[model samples]
Target: MTETARTRYFLLAILLIALAAAWPELSQPGLLNTRGGGDSPFLLQRLQQLETAVLDGHFPVRWMPDANYGYGYPFYNFYAPLSIYITFLFRLIGFSFVRSIHLSHLLGYFVAGWGMFLLARRWFAHGGAGNGWAGLLAAAAYTVAPFHLVNVYVRGDSLAEFWAMAFYPLVILAADGLFGGGRRGVALFGLAYAGLILSHNISALIFSPFLLLYLLLRMRFLTKKQENYPQACTEQSRSISQITQIGFFKSYKNLRNLCNLRIANPIFGFLLALALAAWFFVPALAEQSLAQLDAVTSGYFYYSNHFLGTADQPLIQSTFFVDYGVVDREAFRMGLVQTAVSAAGL
Candidate 1:
């Protein structure tokens, strides 16, 4: 197939996976059951609060009017703003808040699939995975990932996290492309990393170390010397010893080029990314003491009590934590299909 045709095919397949993953939201005809369950209700309320605050000329929206039973709180000061802002854009264009939420979910899934496809294809090209089908499989695996679906349909639909996940591959791809030689590479990496931070601060924090490790490995790949030694010296006029010495001399001379890893790419990219995301995180960290971190971390929501895979319970049953609350509990499993795929991989 032509290059354009191949691109189209990849995109079409990705689009189908995105649509399939978001089918539940697309199929519901009536208004969203905001009260159905999970954190969706809280997120919807936050969306409306954001709209109100924005309309009131609150650019950063630190204080929310209706938080804590009508006494306002600095909701936007700490919360990541990208997802709600995106859904609010649809609201500005005349879509209802409910409809906007649905649309955002669709858009999030599609973006996730697209990002994964691009990253997977690049990885395949670099000989990390098989080409063509590998990209599609990666995208599909991520889009319909078990915990992701459970988060969307069960855990109050953490739209921020969904959007954050969508941007992960894009950030990695941009960082990887930094070594491929282009003036725009660092700028693009900066933007992608900024998007990740703005989408979900926690996700950005969790993924940062992994990103740094990957970049270090990539730099190593660039600096590692090639090992194509002369098997049979053909030119007898130039003795084998002479040929070997010449080859060694040339390799030694070009050592600088081989080790030409742009160590500044990540530093510059990270500085730019920090500058871009400063609008949110600056006030977030600075003014965090005003907010009661104890309230957020204490009680049933204690950070230590809810770590995944940390519990000794069986994976299937351990999915359900905090069984004491009156709220309906949903146990999320990482699907049998994914397990089978993992087994096949092993």
Candidate 2:
């Protein structure tokens, strides 16, 4: 197929997957039931409050006056606010609170699928390794991946994290472009990384190392050096001093090549992302100690104590049945079909 036809076909597939994934919410417009227990209602309230605050000249939107029974709480100041901001925009464009939340969730799936397609296309197209079909399959596999469905259906209230997850592929693709010598790639990387950070701080923190490692792997080709001396060069063929001098020159040339724009661009992108997200992260870091941050990680919620395998539930049972409560511990198995397809791809 022509490039335009291929692009359109992939987009159509992404849209269909998005629609299917969000059918439950779309089918029942006013239904706001979620596995988040009371958290969903509180999130809705917070979004409404944030909208009002911004409209009423709250610049940073740090404090929520109605929270804590009107004593006020600095929730948004430390919390990731991009998802809420998107919901606010949806509300501004005449969507109801419930509809806005559902739409945001739906949009996350679409963006993630599209981003995965972009990355896979680039990966397969590199050195003519594969074709558009590979990218399409990848996009389908990622969109229908069980973890994404679980996030939307189970942890619906945590839209920020879901949004952050959606941006992961975009960040990878943009980083790939930056390392591949695309001039606009640095700006794209900065924007995507900033979006990921603004969506969820923890996801950004976890994914940053992976992004750096990917850049490092890609830079290897650029930094690799050819051995000027032959492998069979015996002591008789070349003097020790001459061999040392040749090795030194090769090393210096490799070092000089490594110092070029390809290596520097990705680093610049990372710095730019930090600069873009400074408004949220700077104050959040500065004032974190003042808040009851410990309370968040204390008691039953302690990270170290709640390992995944602690539960006695069987994998088969957990895989199919959706837990009504404690959705975090819900069956996390990607469906058999998805797993098989993924393995086939591998």
Candidate 3:
């Protein structure tokens, strides 16, 4: 709300947008070129298909009629097409296809940082004396994170995956809001979870358990806080303790009693996500046998080589071509600064 806070956010956004295009494609308008530069090649065509589907009044828009050598491909049926659909919306607003692609990615980067800033704000500033500089640090760190850069620039893996991962923080933010015992974030959690699912099914699958775990952890914290508030308040006989609960944890009174907490907020959020994403996953699952899903269990996905490695051992040594002749093997790194800070925090 303050001018200083606005300035922090503006500066962070500018830095993130600049980072999105720092690579500078050799022969494309977007950040990444289409000359075998990850998935950029087919993304525009998908955009075109989405636009045609809209014009033809197809409700769900499953089949890509122009794909598969004129026989058509069921692209949208299995692959979540929300990101392409966003590009289509950009198309509707009179931007050229290339411009839409550029804007969509730039928006993804900006929104990702914005969401991180909000989460950081709540984390470092909630119920305490804090400043936006902490949020700026968090937002900037997230925006420049290496793996995220891979998703947006290097690998350009899937636009859907990028957006799915980008919005993941907002899901946690909503959960955090709910943990404080209010309906403030129920709708946001629902919509964000649904959109994440529709953005990329595999990512949704990967992120779902963590979301559940975070909800459970928050719930436990809330319950403990509420149950102990009375006892802590009754301790008026002693001086206020400071150093006993860690620097941040030294302030338990900040969380308050959370007396209005209902155990149903997270349940409602889960139900809403399921309801919204059922339209996509219901068919994706029920019709699984009809597709070549059996292939997922074999070949590259065979269990023998997929074991989670121990601390002394490295896991998978996988690599993917990110550009015409450029292969990226270290796409999974979280960056040195992030890794150090995260470990310190833990």
Candidate 4:
């Protein structure tokens, strides 16, 4: 509402517009060609399979072997269905299936800008000590983060990663509210968890443990406070403390309390994300592919073998050629350098 605040938002708006304009080029059928790089073809194949399913009204599982993908390939059993369902909805709007898939990704990245704004506002609320400047700082920092540039330049990986990262802090906040005993807030917590899980399973997995750790610490604090209450009103407190302390005698006691507390909702959220592919949890759970894991691990080894082993190697050796086009290896190099400089600034 002040002049400085207006200036900050204005700059953010301009940066967002620039990001939006860059999307089409990054994902254009031919230009900036990273789509043919390792694991990329598999992602595109999965999307193409979804497009086919949307057209045929049938789900197909074996478009390609999972061994060609990254760490989260087993989760494709989950991702495929979600993508098909969404593509179908877009088709209903008269868009071609291929266009729909591309548009979905483009729009997903575009909306991420708004998510960045929300994150910044939330950070400002806490870190700014209620000052507007803090929020603006967060927004600008997020907008210019090297990761955002990578997400924008690389098309397929952008949507899910951006969505997951953008919504990650909100998931923490919602879970925080739920653990605080506001039942209605728990539903929002559930919604945020569900959304992120659906967007990207691996990203969700990486985030889930952190979410659980935070919740456990917060809940323990609450329990401690309750224990300090009058004895007549602390029946639950006594019972919970006894259960947690029971582990002093038996390791299983801790497991029993964990089951009772259902402290694993974060894990459940991780598993539930598999619903993007199947109706019941079991079917998706079963289809997770170990081959995908192998492929991902190999890719990492490939990258490390080339880069870390020899510093004087061609800077471009670490880069993969995706199809007929070339990635700007220098852009990546500069991006990392800039990122380090930016973090130091922070």
Candidate 5:
């Protein structure tokens, strides 16, 4: 067999191994239900409040304290109602809130995986490295990522992260289109971005800066292309020269080109997005924006830990890059490196 076949088979083997490792976690009921009964119960309680308010025609803007929790609502300043609306829809259809949330995660995972595959395909095509294998690798890598696995385990605010991860590929497509890649990519991008914003406000906030930076990079690439136009012009260079000779006018034209991306290819897809978004956006926004808000004392927990001498407790922090466990330093170090290497597909 050829080297490519060998590599493909190897990747397939690795994928199967990973999936096998994940089976125990996935097979168990509520495997993603990390909040367990305590947090899950609280989450359901919030959804119940949201359901009542929506049915009553006034979903509160800020969250109200759950009678059971007694403490004020912890999620005041940060609020996004996509998950709540999803739960409410299920409740309307006779499903329990917990079941509805679980179903949403299960379904959302499919969308995320498919979207990632398509996005990776498009990206590889654009990069002149058209490999379906690469796309598959990326899609699988993202879907079974540690962050995603952890989210499944915790199964609370992490739902937002899952939604964000799922839509990320589309965002890249849209940004690419905005820079003159293609109308379809741009349109898919806009619809994806809007859906992401509506699903998780915090994720949108975090993603916006990266989107803007990509635009900036594309603009720079255009400038470099113009500068490389030859002194003795070919047809392409003549066009470039004519355009670049206009100086500020050329700059303005480039900016306008980047900004005015009217996507026509994905009209149907975007329309579906619009329909889904309409179901929840306004009500969710109203509830989130108007809810009684509070400012948590940032770092208070950290400071309080110091005061109690528990600050010295070993930390187990896991996210994109940082993974540390204080319980066993040697094990932690070995695990971190191994996990990082595996994640990088080494």
Candidate 6:
């Protein structure tokens, strides 16, 4: 197929998947009325507060007046803001709160699918191992993945995490491009990384190690020495000082001779992201003790209590039925067909 034809087909597929995923909310507006269950109701309440705060021209809205029974709390100071801002934009454009939330979910699926397609296509191109069809299938797999569905439909619909997940593929793709001599690659990577950071701090933290690994792998290729260093080293055993000198000179030589822009691209991107997100993170780190962070770490909602296999019921039972309570151990699950497809893909 022509490139345009392929693009059209891919878009159509994404639209179909998004529509299918959002059908429940679209068909029955009442379903959206409930926001989500459990802490989601609390999230919706916070979003309402955030919306009012933004609309009232509260710059860098840190304090939530409605929280803690009007005594106020620094909810926005630490919470990620990108998804909230997007939903606020939707509200500004005349969408109701419920509709805006649902639309965000739909958009998340679309963006994530597109990002996955771009990453897969770029990786395939670099490896010279597959074609566009591989990328398309990969995108499809990601868009309808069971965990993604569960997140959207079952698990309090944590829109912030969904937004972060949506940006993950884009960040990786931008990083790859930065290393591969693409135009404005550093800027693109910075924007994508910033988006990931703003969307969900926890997801950004989870992705950091993988991002570092990718940079290291790319650096290996970008800084490969052309000289026969092994032969030079084998010529004679050297003292510790001499070995240090050789290593320093080799590193300097690699930096000097590095023709590719890849080595500096990710570093620039990392610095730029830190700069962009400093406003939020700075207070978050400094004022952490003031918030009830301990409540989050250890309480009824403690992280330790939420692991898999901690549920009293069988995994199979919990996987199929939606939990009515707030603290179900496994709130997300893979559908039978999705599990089969995942296994096949594996």
Prediction-by-prediction clash tally: 3, 0, 0, 1, 4, 0
Q: CA lDDT of each candidate?
A: 0.73, 0.73, 0.66, 0.50, 0.54, 0.69
Model number with the top TM-score: 2
Off by over 4 Å in 3: 1-31, 34-38, 126-129, 180-182, 227-262, 296-298, 301-328, 334-346
Residue lDDT tens for model 3, 1-346: 7767776766666465545543353236654642254567677788888788778998688888889888887778888888888878788899988778777776776777778877887788753535456766677767666656666566554688788867788888877765433444556788888888899887787788998888778767767776433432323212223422556233544323222344445665677788998888888778877777656658765544333455433333333221223343344444345556668967
Clashing pairs in 3: none
- TM-score of structure candidate 5: 0.59
The sequence of per-residue lDDT tens digits that candidate 2 reaches over residues 250-337 is 6534433433524546665777899999999999999988899888768865644534444553332233333334445544544455
Q: After superposition, how far is residue 263 of candidate 6 from its true place, in Å?
A: 2.7
TM-scores of the models, in the order given? 0.81, 0.81, 0.76, 0.58, 0.59, 0.79
Candidate 3 deviation (Cα RMSD) = 10.1
- For model 5, where is the 10-residue window of minimal lDDT? 228-237
Q: lDDT score, residue 101, model 3? A: 76
| Candidate 2 vs candidate 6, TM-score winner | 2
| Candidate 1, residue 263: how far the Cα is off, in Å | 1.7
Of 4 and 5, the candidate ranking higher by TM-score:
5
Candidate number with the higher lDDT (1 or 6): 1
Regarding lDDT, does 2 or 5 come out ahead? 2
RMSD vs true structure, all candidates: 9.9, 8.8, 10.1, 8.3, 9.5, 7.6
Where in model 5 is the C-alpha error above 4 Å?
A: 1-38, 59-78, 92-94, 126-130, 155-157, 181-187, 223-294, 300-334, 337-346
Off by over 4 Å in 2: 36-38, 126-130, 180-183, 225-258, 302-328, 335-340
Better of 2 and 4 by TM-score: 2
Residue 103, candidate 3: Cα error in Å is 1.0
Worst 10 residues of 6 by lDDT: 231-240
Give the per-residue lDDT of model 5 (tens digit) for 75-148: 52255556566556777889766676666565566556656666676667754434555766676766766556
Measured on C-alpha atoms, candidate 4 has an lDDT of 0.50
Ranking by TM-score: 2, 1, 6, 3, 5, 4
